[model samples]
Structure formats: structure tokens, C-alpha cells
Target: MNEYLTSLDRPIEAVRYAGLTVKLLSTGDGTEVIHHTLQEGSRWSMQPQEGWTASESIFITSGSLKVTVDEETKVLSTGDVVSASPIKQGLVFLALEETEFIYISSQPVFQFFSEIVRKNQELAIEVALKDGYTAEHCKRIMQMSMLIGERMELSPGDMCTLNYASYLHDVGKIMIPKSILLKEGPLSEEEWEEMKRHCTYGKELLEATDSPYMRASGTIVEQHHERFDGKGYPNGLQRDEISPLAYIVSVVDAFDAMTTDRPYRKAMSVENAIEELNENAGTMFHPEVVKIFIDLIPEWSKMKQGV
Candidate 1:
């Protein structure tokens, strides 16, 4: 007698596995069992896709499968299981007259992945906002930085580099201790030291991620704290020793900090902030950077209005 079971009786539900119809026998939180049967000549194409935050396993029940992860490719025979992190997207090709396999995965895997990517994007936005305080502030600083980079006759690529550098100048502050960052009173010397560490901290954070734009950003972070006359922390290298990109970031960063309201002080007027930067030229900021920055303030304000 042929043996066939009803879905309710066997707990096997229908599903699609790598474009093939399959049956999912059961599913629970972070775990599921699926059975798939493949026809002869059926093929599977896998991409480097990983779930946001779960693990996946595919076990061959009959026939075989060809799997490729990164640049490494392998073939798995019947009863063979492949395991990988949920975030890893791999390639799979099917082989055999009738192939069967059990695939397992986390229950909320897709939800978890979506949530993480959403939050990570938000974090990127938040980091940008926190650096400039307001959208307008970021706009003004970016315009000003771009103007200075342009005046220097930098290549289009360098100008793009400068813009991104200014945008993420404070990306390291994500690692700052909240107590110190949010404090309203004058920071103790130790707290001040902690604040300075954001530059180093930001570089390290960017490097740890998969961002390709972070290479130049790493230098900006390292030099954003450096003073024109050389009394900077983490590294005191003075004068032309500081990178040009670092100089641009330093000028933009200081301008935004002074002209924007913070917990400890009211914002200085734009005019006063500009004057202050001019006064510190050659002493605290690169004189050339200060000059170009001053020229861009009006145009920067126009962009700020939109933000």
C-alpha cells in the first residue's frame, strides 16, 4: 500500500526552498525542519545573503547539493548538513534525479534581520544629527567644508572625501559614556579626557565595520582633535604635519560646536563664531582653512535654511 499522510496528521506544511516546492514539518522559535524534493535537472542559485540575526542549516536527505560560500565551493551528498550564520548569504546548486533535504532556521529570523538593518540605518542618521546638533547645522558645516576644499583646488574625489569626512567627523561619539556626554556642568579633567577619546574611538568603530568610505575617515578622526599650533591631544603633531583632510574637519567641527547650543552653553552668534575662528587662525586653525570657511558662511546659511 502506498503511504501518504495528511498535512495535519504529519505536521508537514508546504513551503518553497531555493525555488523548489518543499514541506516544512514543524517550526518553533529559532528552529524549523523542512523537507524538499528536487527534480532532475533542477538548479539552484544562491547569493551572499544572510539573515539579520539567526543561523541556517540545510541537511541533504537524498541526492546531493553544491554549495558555494564566498569563493569556496563544495558538494554535499545525502545526509550532509550545511551550517552558517544567519547573515551569511550563500549559493546552492542542486544535483540528482530526486533530491531531498531538511532545512532549519530561526522563527523570527526575517523580522530580526529587518529590525537590525532598520536600527543600524537610524543609528547612522542619529550619529549625523548628534554631530551637528540640528539638520541645519550639518548643512552649514558641510557647505563650508566643501568651499574650503574647493578653494584648495582639490580633485573631485578629494572634495567628495572632504564632504564625507565632515559628515561623520563625530561618528566616534557613539561610543562615548552617556554620563559624560550629557552632563550639563563643566566636565572634570577626566571627563574632558574621555570626550577627546571619541576621535580615536570613532576611528576604531568605523574600521571594525564593512564601510569602504572609512579609510579616509579614519585619518580625519585621528586629526580632527589636532590643533593648528600643535596643542592637540592623542597626538600633538603640529603645523603641516596634520593632514589636510584633518584640518578641514577640525575647522568645521569647531565651528559647529561653538555655533550650536550645547548642554553647558548657549550657541555663539554666527558672526561671533566666525570672528572667533578668524582670531584663532594660525594659532588654533589653519589660516587658509579659516579664510575659505569665512567666504562660504553665507552660502552655507542658505543650505541650512532648507535643512
Candidate 2:
């Protein structure tokens, strides 16, 4: 019997290039499923490569597209499907409008996608070494963020975004001077301003990478510091203007910060942290996220004690 798999169960390998968004849905056993979305007027060309011998079946799931195989051109609409054999000349695709389609092929063309994942992991390690405190903090934030996401029943895609955002949220600190980042005392106004630039810096760094994980989580990095009452850094976006993933990270980040020792102060007790979360709920953090986090901590503590 054959197995069934949803898109969520498979890792999404996506590339955004030349007005096209190509996602490799699955790559296994010499077969690959690709989802492609092309913007209007965008053209994509594929030339035959030496030693590449795989046929492709293209299905137009939405909008319209123009496909040219060799010298043959065909316009296809929704529900239309076409197949191209392995030829020496290859093919080209043009989106008549905003179009979406699935391309199933028998070749392994997704090695670049795996490379992106590997690069992200290496960057995370570099960031972690730059600040040991942030390294531990990120781990706790990741755990707490995932727990809250599960309680809220976020979709797999959302959870994936949240996970990456939580881990890399402070990656911008790498750009900050060690003097400001590891200062033993409170920052001067100028130093504080420089410190706050981490949010924007993080977003800019991630956006510049153009990696799929970075693209998905860049906004979260930018807006995680924003408060519900509209008084935060980088941007003053408030309330619903912030992404839900940002709100989730904000709550967990704050909780972990409070419960961990800092250069200037001792770690607050869990009870004290809970009180602070409650008091600042709906102002500094999302009220609902704060509530869920506060409720979840006791369970987390019990587990830590192996009770």
C-alpha cells in the first residue's frame, strides 16, 4: 500500500528568484513534487543540462501560463496539464497572469534548498558564540514559544516560522559592539539607542540573506520588541499590527529574560516574573499570550523537577 502525505508533513524547499517562487514539496525515490507560483509577465527558462535526464509533468492549478518546449508554444489555463519529455533543448515558462502550478519531475534538483538550511544552522551557531547569555536565552525562548504555539494550536507552517524566529530573534546583536552588549551597568541613552537597533539590524540581516527561513521570520525579528501599547523599538507597530508569531516570541522572550540572570541584576523568581507578566499584560505583551505562558510555567517547572 502507498502512503499518503500532506504538504505540512514534508519539509518545504522554496526559492524566490526572478519573480518566481518555486517550492519543492517532496523529493524522494527519484521523484520530486514542486509547487511554482509566477508573477504576471515573469518568465522562467530551463536549459538542458549535461547528464540530466528527467521528464516533467506540469499541471496548471490556477491562472494561466505560456509554456514553450523547444519551438512549440502552448497557452494553458486552470486545470490544464502538460508533459515534457527529456529533450536536448529544454523548455521555458511564462506567467500570463499571477499563476500557480505543480511540476512533478524525476530528478533531484533540490540540493540548493538543503544548503540553505545548513547555512542557517551555521549562522545560528555563530550568533550563539557571540553571546553565551543569548545562547541560553534563545533555547529557553524556543521551548516556551513552541509550548505556547502548541497550546494555541498553530498550524505547522506557523510553528516552523515561530521556531526559527525564536532562535534567531536576537541574531542582530552580533552587529552590536561587545561593550554595549555585555555592559555590566545600565546603558546610557546613546548606548540604549544603539542596542535597540538590533531589531532592525536583525531584520535587515535576514532579509539580505534572501533565504526562505529568513524571509519568513524577518518580520518577527523586527516586530518582536514592539509593545501592544505601541511603545517599542524599530517600529511603533501596535496591537494587531504585529504578527502573531512576534507576539508569541515577545512573551516567551520576556519570561526567559526575567527568569535568567543579567549583568545588572539577579534572576527574578518565577512568581515575581509571573507577577510582572500579569501586570504588564495588554501593554508590553499580548494579554492572551501572557496568560497562556503564566499557566504553562507551573507544568514546565514540574517537568524540570521530574515530578
Model 1 ranges off by over 4 Å: 1-132
Please state the error at residue 167 of candidate 2 in Å. Answer: 0.8
| Residues 84-122, model 1: lDDT tens digits | 664344343546566777767664332222232233334
- In candidate 1 the C-alpha lDDT for residue 274 amounts to 93
Q: Positional deviation of 244 in candidate 1, in angstroms?
A: 1.3
Reference-based lDDT, residue 127, model 1 = 45
Q: Report, for every candidate in turn, its global Cα lDDT versus the true structure.
A: 0.63, 0.71
Give the local distance difference test score of model 2. 0.71
Clash pairs (backbone) in predicted model 2: none
